[model samples]
Target: MKYHVVTLGCQMNMSDSERVISVLEEAGYQWTDNEEEAGVIGILACSVRQKAIDKVYSRIHKWNKWKNNKNLVTFISGCILPDDHEKFLKLFDITFQMKDLPELPKMISSYGITTPTHLNVGIDPHNENIEDFWNVQPHYQSNFEAFIPIQNGCDKFCTYCAVPYTRGREVSRPSKDIIAEVALLVAQGYKSITLLGQNVNSYGLDKKGEELTFPQLLREIGELGKRMKKEFWLYFTSPHPRDMTDEVIEVIAEYPVLGKQIHLPMQSGDDKVLMRMNRKHNMEKYRHIVETIRRIIPQATLFTDVIVGFTGETEEQFENTRKAFDEFKFNMSYTAIYSPRPGATSHRWVDDVPLEEKKRRLHQLTEDLRKHNLPYNESLVGQTVRILVRGEDRKEGFLTSYTEGKLTIRFACTDKSMIGQFADVKITSASDFSLEGELVEVAASC
Candidate 1:
């Protein structure tokens, strides 16, 4: 038997697919890249964006057509909104919440597929089985980089977000579990480990008295790093600005393992636009946070998320965002044009921004980002930086990797063994989005 999992959406979804792969592999199934060769197919779906949902529908339609001749079982999970879930139930062989992943092998058995073991069945899908879901060891797809989910779901009801509806209220994993996972990965020679969560900085808030706070969690990981002889970079993502604290910044500065890269999402630079999106934090507060990061982690590279031409946005408001791009000089920005999602709070309001204008605003922000990023890339010329060689580049005889600050750089290297190792590379040239470098030396072999 063979299984294939099609992953969509954010890094969190990618991490979830690893767990799904673990379950399938444990059930005596081999992994396959070709969907036609697999008996079981799964989709780690994402409903946050309409485009992603469209892809799910298109893919499942073709998969269903193949089912007319092939014996295949298909399932869907991860970040699925209720409306989309209702629809997916009809298209997929079985649709379940991500928390019900432990019972997936049982579900396969019920479909008349035999496995090596009789796994426990009849687990309630309605129960909060998040702990069981987290217990499943991920079939880590990368030898060098891994994502450890510290928390699941969201509590902040950002008007433009579908996370609260799809994944439910916030739930933090036990700090001990997180620390153990990081320690094991570090010991296994992983070079990069990102702590995953929707709102990472707000970790342990739901537990209040029981679990460690986000900064405290970082301190624990820092202690583990100090004890170990190996070198690695730690990162986390998509933290709500409202929960970003000075203590978190200080802890990051205190630890050498914690990479000097912060992805603070500034959805909009205009206060009113932010208010309309229910982001909770004003532009002034965001600016103060940036200032704190700069003062504490002076060598840090900044990244951000921005939405262009949001509902009721004016030309002046868009210009304000452009000015913010100039002010922040972000190394990279994941900018998107606003699109109404079905279950989000913003869906009820008028999508007043014209589609063409929305596209124009998106392009404008992208141009602003390029204008800021190129200069920083150029500044690194002749500087030697340590990078984890991730894969081979499209250009032959070159390998692609990211610097300590998560800047993408391709350097000339023919050694295949360097793919999962660290190397020092001297920058030779620069581009708006990436850099060209020459390999200086292999820093470490993992």
Candidate 2:
């Protein structure tokens, strides 16, 4: 039997897919990159964005058509809102929460498809089942880079976000499991490891008395790096500004393995707009966080997420956002125009921002980002920075990689074997978002 997984959305979804692959492979199914060749098809769906949801519907429509002529079992999981899940139950052969992943083999077998009889059959009705889902060893897809999920779901209930509705309240994985995973990956020579969560800095607060805080977790991983004598970069993503503490910043600065990059999301810049989005943090607090980062980790690269033309956003409000952009001078920003999705708090409100105005705002922020990013990229010109070679670039004869600061750079290299290794590159030219460089030399592996 062969299985194919179509992953959509963030790295957290990708991590979920890795575990899904593991479960399928354990049930004697081989993975196929081509959907047409697979007997079992699954989609790790994303409900956060309407565009992503549209892609999921399009894919399932085609997959259902194929089912008329072939024997195939289709399933869907990952970041699915309650409404989407209810709808998916009718469309997909099977639809389950991510916590129910261990029972998937049995679910497939129940369809009259033969599976290993010795497979685990019982499903725990309690939270223990959720723990099992996290315990399932993922068949990691990347040799050089990996994502370890430290926490799952969200509690912030940001009005514009579907995460709280889809994934439920936050659940932090045991710090021991996280440390063990990182230690093993580091020992196996993974060059880059990212700790993934919707709001990473909020980790352990839900289990405050039992689990390690986010800063404490970093300290443990930092100790492991020192003890292992390995050279690798550890990173985390999408932390809420409200939870980003000075302790976390200090821990990051103390650790050499932790990369000097932060992705704090500023969903909207205007105070009223932020309040409407339920971000729980003001512009003043956000500014303070950035100032702290600069003061502590002076060489750190800053990245952020911003939503433009949010509901009821005025022209003056957007101008405030633009002013915020100018004030922060972010190296990069994942800017998106607001789009209401069913099941989110914001969905009930009228989407007052016009589409054309949304597009205009998006473009304006993008230009602001580029204007700020170019100077930082330009500053790297003539400097040699260490990069983990990702793969070949779209431009022929060049290879693609990212610096420790997560800056994308393409360089001329014939040695394809260097793709998974670290190398130093001399920046020759700079663009708004990326850099052009030449390989200085591959770094010696630890």
Candidate 3:
């Protein structure tokens, strides 16, 4: 049997799909890229974004249609909101949470598709099964880049978000397991490692006294990097401002392995809008964290997530967000047009922001980002910076890569063999978001 997992949403979902792949492969099912070739097609979905949720429905519809003529097993997993969860149960052959991944093989076997471990019972999917989910050896899709899930779920239930309803309470994975995975990946020549979580920096807060804090965890990893003497970039994402401590910034400043890139999500710039979203932090708190990042790690490229339209968001409130773009001068901003989602707190409230207005606001923010982003890239015109060779670019004869700060740069490279290696590149020209450069030197992955 062949299987294909269609992943959507955040890096956390991508990491979850890795474990899901592990379970499917263990059941004697071979992997497939084409959906038509697979007997088992699973979707690792996201309920956070409206578009991703829409894709889930569209994909399952086609899969179900295919089942009219062919014998196929379709399953759905990952972060699913209450509304989507109910609907998915009626659509997919098997519907389960990410924590219940161990039950997947058994559930599929009920359809007469037997596997080696189909009869293995007594595994409770509803209990604290996230720990067991983590124990499943991941079949990573990428050889050079990897995502290590350090935490699962969300505790801070923002009003406009459905993550709390979907993922449940926060649970930090053991630091030892994460560390071991990181060490093994580094030893196996992985160049990029990102720690994944809903609230990544708030890692140890759930288990306070027993576990290492986020900074402590980074310190341990930094020490490990120093001992190993390998060239790699360590990154984490989407950390809440409430959990963005100065200690974490200090740790990153002290560590050589930690990438000079920060992705702090500032959902809205206006204080009133933030309060309406129940984001738990004001604009001032977010500003202070940005100040700390700039002061501590001056070279760090700042990235953020922003929502354009929310319930009752006024013109002044949106103008505040526009002003914030210039104030922060983010390198890359993921601007989202807000839409009410079922299972989220704000969904009950009237979605007053018109769709056209929301789109206008999003486009305006993109323009604002371009105004600031281009100049920064232009400043690197003649500077030689070390970048990790990621892969070939859309334009032939050039390979795409990223700086330590995660800035995209494409340079002429006839040798695709240098994909996983590090190379020093001298910038010749710049675009709004990417740069053009010439390769100066190449270093093999250690």
Candidate 4:
């Protein structure tokens, strides 16, 4: 059997799709990038935004056409909003949660496909073709830093969000399991590891005993990286302010292995707007958190997610958000115009923000971000920063990776094999988004 998977949404969804493929492969299914050649198809969906859901609905006809022509057994999974699941289930022959993948091979077995292990909880991906699961095979998609999911789902049900509805409650994988996986990847010559989750800081919160929060996990991983004979990079993402504890900041400050960047989602900057969004934290609390982080790691780069035009956002409220942005001086900001998602608590209220105003606010925010960002990069023009070279730059012969603070820097390197190695680069030029540099020294063998 052969299968094709279409993934959408965040890194968490991408990692889930890969695990689904791992399950299929374990059950003797082959992968085909082409939908026309597959006996089975998987649509790894995203339901965060109404626009995303509409695109999924639009793709139904294409999959239906494939089904009519070749009788493909289509399966849909990944971040599926609860309200749309019934409708999506009707569109595909099968629908299941990404978390239910352990039972997939057995589900296929009933359809006459064979597999090795019994369907049960705590099933290991390492049972068969372990190296492929770690993505050591030459047949894998890309060769660079990899996203290794350490936890799943979210606890924060912000009014405008659908992740909690689609991905269920937060659940953390065992620390031992994650550590072993990291060890395996490092042994296989992987240079970087990005620990992915909806709320990475909330990792291990539900686990038994003294829960391993994001900060604790960072410290543990930092210790492991320090002990490793080889040099490797570590990063995690999309953490909530509620869980951004002090220990995590200290770990990043103390350990050079962990990337000196943190992506904290500040959905809204106005206290009233945040309350309306059920974000829990106030502007004062957020400022203190950022201040603490800066105190702990002065050189740390910060990125954030901001939503413009949330319901009931007045001009003053928007200004408050702008003030927050100015105060933080974020390295990068992902700004979005608020679009109400179905089945979410906030969707019950009127989406009163006008489209034109939303765009205007978004534009204003972008312009302000530019004012702060250019000078920040300019300051790095003479410093030599270590970067893990990932791939060739899109525009020139230079290679690119990220600095400790997750800044994208490009530099000319003499060694072609330096793509996966860390090299010191002396900054020569700076842009709002990237730094131009010249390679100083490429560390050999690590």
Give the Cα error of residue 26 in candidate 1, in Å.
0.4
RMSD of each: 3.4, 3.4, 3.2, 4.8
In candidate 3, stretches whose alpha carbon ends up further than 4 angstroms from where it belongs are 112-127, 442-446
Off by over 4 Å in 2: 112-128, 442-446
lDDT (Cα, tens digit) per residue for candidate 1, span 311-392? 8999999999999998989999999889998789998989998999999999988898899889899999999999889998
Give the best candidate by lDDT.
1
List per-prediction Cα lDDT, in the order shown.
0.89, 0.88, 0.88, 0.77
Give the 10-residue window scoring lowest on summed lDDT in candidate 4.
116-125
Compose the digit string of candidate 3's lDDT tens values, residues 134-158: 8888999889999999988888989
1-446 in candidate 4: lDDT tens per residue? Answer: 88888888887777766677777886789998877888877788888777777878887778797655676676677777666776775676666665566656555555434231222122122223222333311122445577777666677889998777776677777676678777767777777778888888888777756567677778888888878776777888878888777778888888877888888889888999999998978888888889988898888898999999999999999999999888999999999999888878888999998999999999999998988999999999999988888787876666787887889998765456788877788999998888998877544422
Instruction: Tell me the tens digit of each residue's lDDT in model 2 across 35-67.
Output: 999999999988888889989999999999998
Total clashing pairs for each candidate? 0, 0, 0, 0
Question: Model 2 — which ten-residue stretch has the worst lDDT?
Answer: 117-126
